[model samples]
Target: MASSKSVLHIITELGRGGAEHMLYKLLSAMDGNLANHHVLSLGSGGPYAEKIRALGIPVHELGMRMGRPNPMLLLRLRGLVRKLNPDLVHGWMYHGILAARLAAQGRPVVAGIRHSIYKLSSEKFATRLVIRAVASLSPSLAALTYNAHLSLDQHRNIGFSSKKACVIPNGFDPDRLRPDPKVGARLRAELGVQPDVFVVLHAARFHPMKDHKGLLQAIARIKDRNMVFLLAGTQVDSGNPALSGIQDDRVYLLGERDDIADLMTAADCLVNSSWSEAFPNVLGEAMACGLPAIATDVGESAAVLGGTGLVVPPRDPEALAKALVQMKDMPQEQRIDLGKRARQRVIETFSLSKVASDYLASIKMFWMPTAGDGPKDVQEKEFLVHVRNRGVYQLAGRSGWGRADFAHHDRCGAPSWPR
Candidate 1:
């Protein structure tokens, strides 16, 4: 039966942030186009709006001015909510969470907390105000979900409610992200990286939070001249003054490219130097693409790795350099084995279908209204671990990972992951 329930997603913006990517993935991965989905962004929808629209979903932008609150945003959001009358409203990040809470009007509203509260000082003043606001107002929301277990605890320490909090890790499509030899070759050729070079990919915008300088120091320590660093993200190119110290001939700056999945294909490793994160998707993405990773010990990074890659302390360039050398020195067979395990970890635990099922289950737990039955059906049919010990990963024609409906995998049956 077509579910009567529709979900409205509210976010600060539909930029390329991890939260936006996850939201897009969630809606796209819904089985049978399950629940009717709509999105409202407080700012311009940005590049991702078109991608989400391509999925037959509608996206609304409130044109809210960033770095400052727009009081009228509430009025616009309230009107939109009344018109759409969604069965549930889900908010992403602090700004969107409070806005959703204000507009829900006693209806079921769930908030998503995607950033790690590593320290209160890490938050901007505007966001700090929202965090404080939510501290008192979170109880009104039906439930709150943290992308990382660490984020949940950190927020609780800062006086956010723990009474109705849960963790739902981000999900990925192994099929879409797995290693492609041809794609990798094409990417390397396009980037002018030599066939013999050991390529390490770093993806993050030019922000102090990313600690790009730490990574540059680590790269300097790597003795191999054949080593190449492919830097991506907004303003991560040589023209950025922050990267002026990077005089290595092998350093290739790709300011911002949409085909990150293709770049992941060509990468020998993915490095994340973020000082704080909730659930950094780049490491998981690299793993999904069958590449080893070296990431700082930020929010859920080590956890996300699942022993599939190396994790070092944040802001430690020496340790990161050592890890790089270790990776470069490892035998190709051993590295390949690690890469295989990395891919397996993503497939087993973080596949888009599995995480989507968990999300749907959480929604069911929060609100039991009969109107919200579409995702409930998906949770039962596609994400089941076992089928009478026949040993399969997902049901035929409903895996929810991609357009393909009948893909299956062989593995011992486990609750969250069978294969």
Candidate 2:
């Protein structure tokens, strides 16, 4: 038996968002015999820290905060990376990519680009700078995995390395997220929602990008008193001042929830109103629960639906309202059939086990061979071998993986194949 390789995952934070949840789900689905995993958060560890720890994986925190960059953390990160000496360093987002590039110290580093970029100027000044920097440094990376094909195309258009880019959409576990009428009934009873009332779910953190205001406006356009919208995520409760003036009797603000699967089971349909997204995890989770969805045509949303649900233009409240009405007015049997097909789509296309295996395969491509097994001189060289088109390209140069040397080596020789 071969020894399990080490993988270090660095993310912007450990918050309860799509990226965070995906990381947790991926870790749970991955085969432990192949690799040992460790997670490092550039910012404070949020809800996911303990959840990840529960799986027996070590989680480290840098104690950084939003809009605040700490230079001292670089030294700490570098020291930690050196200490871990992981076979692969996987950065989860733009900030994590920046940190990974800065601290990898000639180690192989792969990046996860999780968001969509429609326009560069629309981004904050700081974020724009980071994007430019990441783009400039992208050419030498061993690999760049995107959660959506749309995100990969958008980033590549903005100068990200197309050669190293690949798409790996988000995955869902049907067993954990499937429909349960009993659980749905229990949830509705607890929430005081009548069995006949129509429930529309929008589960995402309260952020400008999520466009909670747009969702609220769309719900307001509807006159159906029996229809209620359930908003669930971090800071998405009644206490949020931004939502105060618009929220009404028909709107239920559910603060951060661990029982989203139950909520999905209870809801009649899911709505994703975000103007931007790479691959919204909640949509798939809702689908896995056998709930139909209505979403904006953003970042693989329509593709995920695969003709199973409704798709509308982004930031269009009237269209959203119309879709809501359309979904609500559909015959119960037809809607239930759609929900069943949606669940089947998730099972056949986005099973967590299959996606986790893809992730593991991508990671292993850059895992270096044991030192003595490779040629002595080649073992001493600090570089990552990227296999593309049957050729091996050196991914890391002297200072960083900022330059690539397209030199193919015999697969049977030293550093024959990545372990």
Q: Rate the local accuracy (lDDT) of all candidates.
A: 0.78, 0.81
**Candidate 1: which pairs clash?**
397-405
Off by over 4 Å in 1: 365-367, 370-419
Per-residue CA lDDT of model 2 for 1-419, tens digit only, reads 43468989999999888899999999999878888899999987688999999998999999887678888889999999999988878898899998898988887778898899988999999989889999999876767888876687788889887655656678899988899999998999999999999999999989988999888888889999999888999899868899766547989889889999999988999999999997899989988999999989887788788778999999999999999999999999999999999999888778897778767766765554565654323322322333333222122311111112334433322121221
TM-score of each: 0.87, 0.88
Superposing all C-alpha atoms, what RMSD in Å does each candidate have to the true structure?
7.7, 7.7
Model 2 poorest ten-residue lDDT run: 394-403
Candidate that would win on lDDT = 2
Expressed as tens digits, the lDDT of each residue in 215-269 for candidate 1 is: 8888888778878988899888878987766778877888888988899888888
Task: Name the runs in model 2 displaced over 4 angstroms.
Answer: 368-419
